[model samples]
Target chain A: MDLRQIWILYRHEVRSALRDRSIVVMSIVIPLVMYPLLLWGTFAAMNFVEGQAERLTSRIAVQDAPPAHRDWIDSLSGMGGVSVSEWMDDEASARESVARGRMDAFVRFESPPAEGAGLEQNFQLRVLYSAARDRSERARSQVEEALVLYRGAWIEGAREDLGISDPEWSGFAVVQEDLATPEEATRFLLALMVPMLTLIMVALASFYPAIDATAGERERATWETLMTVSASRGSIAAAKYLHVATFGAMGGLLNVGALVLSLRWILAPVAGPEGVGGGGLPLSTIPIIAVGTVLLGLFVAAGMLVFAIFARNFKEGQAAITPFYMVTILPAIFLQSPDIELTNRLALVPVINLVLLLRSAIGGSLALGPGLLTLASMAVTVVLAVTFAQWVMRREDVLLGSAGAGLWEFLRSHFLRRKGKA
Target chain B: MNREPVRTQALTKVFYDESRGQVRAADEVTLSCSEGEILGLLGANGAGKTTTLRMLSTVLRPSSGKAWIMGHEVRDAPEEVRANLGFYSASTALYPKITPRETLRFFATVNRYPADRVAGRVDHLIERFGLGDYADTRVEKLSSGMKQKVSIARTVAHDPPVLIFDEPTVALDVLNAIELREIIADLRGEGKAILFSTHIMSEAEKLCDRIAVIHGGRILATGTLDELRETTGLHYLEDIFVRFAGARNAGSAERENAG
Candidate 1:
């Protein structure tokens, strides 16, 4: 196996892939443009919805309140987010109005408050609203808040009448503190999304090029010519694998960069001004993530090339590669759960280990041992996949497009036949 | 006497078919092509013409046999064998996205042609094959004849001593086929040992210095045209082939009946 020959084959594969417009569009353009647009669109939509919600005014009606409650109803009208109106119908009619969206909510007082009940007042208040309607729910909460304030004022007035001036009688103060830094919280949120997105983009980036290089050659009837050349099958397969791995790595990097840049705006409201980058992963973690991306890219690319070569044509290659893509994605989705961590056992798994390692690395908590383990595991798998690809290429029936047994059955028979000959 | 550029001893290939048990795609066949000689492998489709050519080119492994290209054993030294031989089939295609020049350069580099001589050799072949106008055009945009010209140029880019062509004219128009015959004659003039397979009797008659009649994975006869005619008592090559194939079929039927 000549390294120069491998380089020549690799260069040709890369040049061919570059010339293919579909591969260029799928790998580079989509990652660079689509992610930013998708992120910007989502953020803009959320902002618009929030603005609309804030400007909305909800109407509330009072039902069956005695004339003596006029002052309290007038106070409710003075508050914001509500337009209190007279209820000329029964309780059912007020509820029907709320359900129909004509009124946002209704406050039904079962009976007028006892004349001088003071602190022991025992009156039933029912707040009716359509839970399915956002405005109705908002209006009900506002009305409830106003009533609580009014009750507080009444209690304060009674306390003044009794000449009680101690402020401690209001309630005990409850203070809350969040232990997480802005970075840690942002990392938590990004850990769920970034890894999955990166894996998906890597798969997409490598898919077309892998299929184009292997099965595409066969479909174009160029495989036989390629095989007859002086280059060893191992060199040829390695060159193709390098071409696919380069695309996969580029995709992974571009996706991470795009996600980082876009999430600054996309997650601003959720993660604050520092956003996805703020306090989350340190600048040092970038190199670690970069390394992980390359390893994962190589792993996935090798696996995809092996499967793609089994197919006789481009469409058949796509069909053959879909299940592999799905299998890789399943582990990524499983890794999205915060409960799954980078443990020794998990580090032994292929795709799952890479995702976990990336998540840990990006979140700035990657331990040295497990990170090394994940890298080593992926490297071994890539080697095995590439070896298998080289073996497949040497088979006469496969290279010549002759009808034969399925790959596994053929390999089994081939090995047994060799053993018998020996 | 010139050295033999291609030789085989008991070359064979067996394919296992679920319905037919074991099918001998190429039986224990032995033949040789010497420098400055053109050996036309004459056989109909499915008569092991391709299977035999493929084994000699090291594209398919012989089940139990030895073959050599320019004295390099195919199985033991495939890279050396490939370095010394050029194989072309009618179905062989060029990379569609690459230009003809680029295709030749790729082949030259892979075949380890001297780095300094690749460009000059490629240019000479381009002019020789009348591909100057489409040398820089993507192969997918080239006409079928032009593409075949590029294919043949790339096959011989390293100037190997042995050339194997399998049905090279099967897809070519009459003009292109005639052009290919001229190219094969030129290669022979350059003292390259050329073995090509063809079912077209006239093509074999016009181009082959010697003919090897193949049928059912075995060569029935091999000699000069007159020598073959004298042996089979048939004047035309087609009638000679029919007699050979018919006799083999009758023998097989008789054996089946006896069983």
Candidate 2:
């Protein structure tokens, strides 16, 4: 309860943690550069794979076509990345060849032949290809593209033959337009990704600091020294919990900053420069993101400390903390489903609610009532996590890791013993 | 309020070790140290030296009996007991990243030293522990000897009237061990009640104003070196320790046989 003593211990923990390489790397360096570097790596990998696919030659064969289509078949032989060949076999044989991978695709002409070799003629064509093979699929698409060009030219000739001066109307014309601004388009996707990324990054950032503050102290033989100080156990717990939580929250916000800055580039591969706009989140939602991130840090950080303190050594502490980190962030991942919205019932759920709150806030559709409800649930969860951490600090088994006991047995003894006493 | 700076009445601690079943690490340990006196708890390893001192420092709660530090009962007012006591053992360590000056200032502030006087107290501890040369360097970068010096300085940063040294020289070289002995003697000279524990007979012979021989979690005998010699008709402190510890072990064997 002594604020001054807590402040003293808190400052010391911060100063020491800043000097730790593992903590600094996770809390600062990773947040600042992890998103951009990972996105860049992914972007480069995609380009490499696309280039390889582009270089692959797709083989196609023309079989049993009438003499009039010989010119089109000959032109296909000269097309880029298409090695077209003449097939002397029957239509069924050509199809079998395509299926057996002897060729990428086959083309055949059905009977009920054209009435004449003129613009008014009607023809039946079927393209054969495997859906599983990349080359077959590509050949099919290339054949379709070539057919489209040929049909356009045929349409003009048909108009001339029919004595129709206007070539614009191909029966009916359809025009499409999008009403979304570049920023709005960017925000739509950002709303889905930012919340999940925030949860994961913040959870990861606290991983090392939590272990260093708790089990690392015991391993280095410093916990006894710190415990000998005049501060009450509650004060020490408060200071340690806040110190680690601040690091986690700070890492998350920095990651958001880095992510926003990298947004234009991350989306550039899909949406050209102008398509994604400046890639900034809706400015109005910053306050909501900030408050939600802080509450999340509080809850997640204490969860990490509780797990870490239960372990006997640095290695065991890491093993204990990894699962808790995954568990906290895993719930937020479910929010990736666009079907999940900030409904009245969903807003009462803990981390899922925060994700919904952030998603709604970013999408510019957040209702005040749901937003407040989400924040309240997160606050209540934070209070519980912190109170549990403080109470655990008073336990001798927790303070001095349960000697030689399995993690479950350690926990069972403490909780059961305390309950029985009460 | 207790007049003695350090006092205890039949202190005991029982640990539940799976292999050993129930072990009494410290059994009804009664002892006291007055101001300007160094009371050496002379015993071998696992003879309840550390456990007894740990109880007095309020780091471990006793299963039974009571202890006081500067007039504050350990169980009722642990924070006050910690504020008035300085505990230094081989296991107590400093933060490797902070400078010695910062370590001292932090300890002083947290131990409830007045805000304005913290700086002066830290400066005094630095000089007292001879930490002037590498005081600014990170403790990890300092040599082992220098790190030990910082550890000693941190123990007395709060200027507590009661100080406990529990096998502090166990990990130190001979030169650093001598330096620490001199420091303990100097603290006693300044009227601080000191409880020094060690298995080394020469250490107790050279420093302790009075010696308490302990064995099997109990203090077998307590007296000045001359007083003990007078009772046992022995000149050497090692022989005297054996006389007490040996007799206690033999008595346990006899009781076991009787059972």
Candidate 3:
């Protein structure tokens, strides 16, 4: 309970952690540089693939179009990346050619154009393209667009010939109006990614330091040195908890910050200019997200420290704590579907609640009941994890690696034991 | 009477090994070291030397009985005991990244040393231990000899009245071992009661004011070297140790047969 002793021990860990190259690199440098590199590499690869797909020509065979539509049919050949060839074989053979990649598409009008009742040709057009082939699908779409344009032009000519006004044919038009604010537009984009990112980055950040604090001390033969100091085991645990949690929170924030800062550039191609039209989150939700981040840091850092205490060395510590990384991530992954909302029951689930809470906050409609439950849920988990870690730290055999018990035995002894027993 | 700086009464520790059930690592060890005294626990490996010292330092909890550091019971007041004691063993190592000066200052602050005296105490230890040349260097960057000196300085950083050294020279070279003995002797000269453990007979004979012979988790005999020599009629401390260890093992076998 001595603040002075805890502070001294905390400073001890901080000094060691700052100089420990692995901790610095994992928690600071990687988070700072990783997002930008990932965004750049992704966009570059996407552009290359799209450019390659665009430059390939679409070859289509046109068949049985009357002289009235011949001009428009021939225009397909004039369009860029489109080649039109007349079909001389049976329709079956032409369809086969499209499927086998000999032709990208087969454009066939019904065998005969029906004479319309009043100066209009009534014919059904069938465009055959292989869905499995990208070129075939593109060719069909190109031909379809050209045919529509040709029909519109013909209608214009026919109207002129009949002396008809434009209002006679055009009757209705549909216009779309979006009333979303800039904050809402950017907020929806956060719900899907931020939850998983926060958990994963915090978990990763907590890894090396927790191991260094517990198993690293044992390996370096300094655990006994620390044990003999005047600080209580609980104080030592608290100091270590503060140290690891700081790194975890810093890492998650840095990565999220870098990504949010570059949100416009990263989303421009996919979401268009309006993707990040205004760069601001709702002021009310910032505190919620901040609390969530802090809670996540505490829970994950305490859990990592608990698991790491079971190990006698760094390698064993990593093996011991690796399962925690997956368990931390699996809940986020389970809540991947945004429709997974925080019902009263789901609100108490650990990582899922955080995901839902953050998602609801980003979407600008976080209900008070769910938000409080989420905070309480995470707070309880943090307390339990930290308490268990502190308890383990006080055990002579666990701290000294003298006991033969592993993870299962530790848990069994803790959870399954009778009242008032060790 | 002089105050006992380190005292234990019937202290014991039992560990359950998978192959060997219910092993008593330290059994009914009753011993005490007074002010300005050097007491040695001499035994072979796994003869309860480290275990007894570990109990006194509050590293290992005693399964039965009690140990006190400067009259503070280790079980009830662990931090209190640690505040009055300094422990240095092979396992009590210096932080690789911390300089010796920082190590001393940090330990002093943690052990509740006076805030104003910390800087002076740290400087004194630095010069006293001849760590001036490498005092600012990280422990990992220092030579083994230099690191050894820093470790020794770190042990008494808080200027505790009671010190326990559990086989600290087990890994040191012969020359370094001799140097460490001299350092320990100097600490005793400053009136610190030290409980030193070793398996080496010469280390006990030359350095310890009183030596306790331990075997099979129990202390077979405890007295000054001259008193032990007289009682056992043995010239060398090594033969006396063998005789004591053999007697304990033979007594155990005979008791088992009778049972």
The numbered model that scores best in TM-score is: 1
Q: Candidate 2: which stretches are off by over 4 Å?
A: A42-67, A70-141, A151-180, A264-274, A403-407, A415-422, B1-3, B18-21, B253-259
- TM-score of candidate 2 on Cα atoms, chains taken together: 0.86
Q: List the residue pairs that clash in candidate 1.
A: A183-A279, A183-A280
Q: How close is candidate 1 to the true structure, as a TM-score?
A: 0.88
RMSD list, candidates in order: 3.9, 4.4, 4.3
- Number of backbone-clashing residue pairs for each candidate, in the order shown: 2, 0, 0
Off by over 4 Å in 3: A46-175, A264-273, A403-405, A413-422
TM-scores of all predicted structures: 0.88, 0.86, 0.86
Q: Deviation in angstroms for A279 in model 2?
A: 3.1
Clashing pairs in 3: none
Q: In candidate 2 chain A, what residue range of length 10 has the lowest lDDT sum?
A: A112-121
A314-406, model 2: which lDDT tens digit per residue? Answer: 898899898888788887876688777898888888888888899999988899898898888789888988887888777765666653343
Give stretches of model 1 more than 4 Å off: A51-173, A263-273, A277-280, A401-407, A411-422
lDDT of 1: 0.84
**Candidate 3 displacement at residue A257 in angstroms:** 2.4
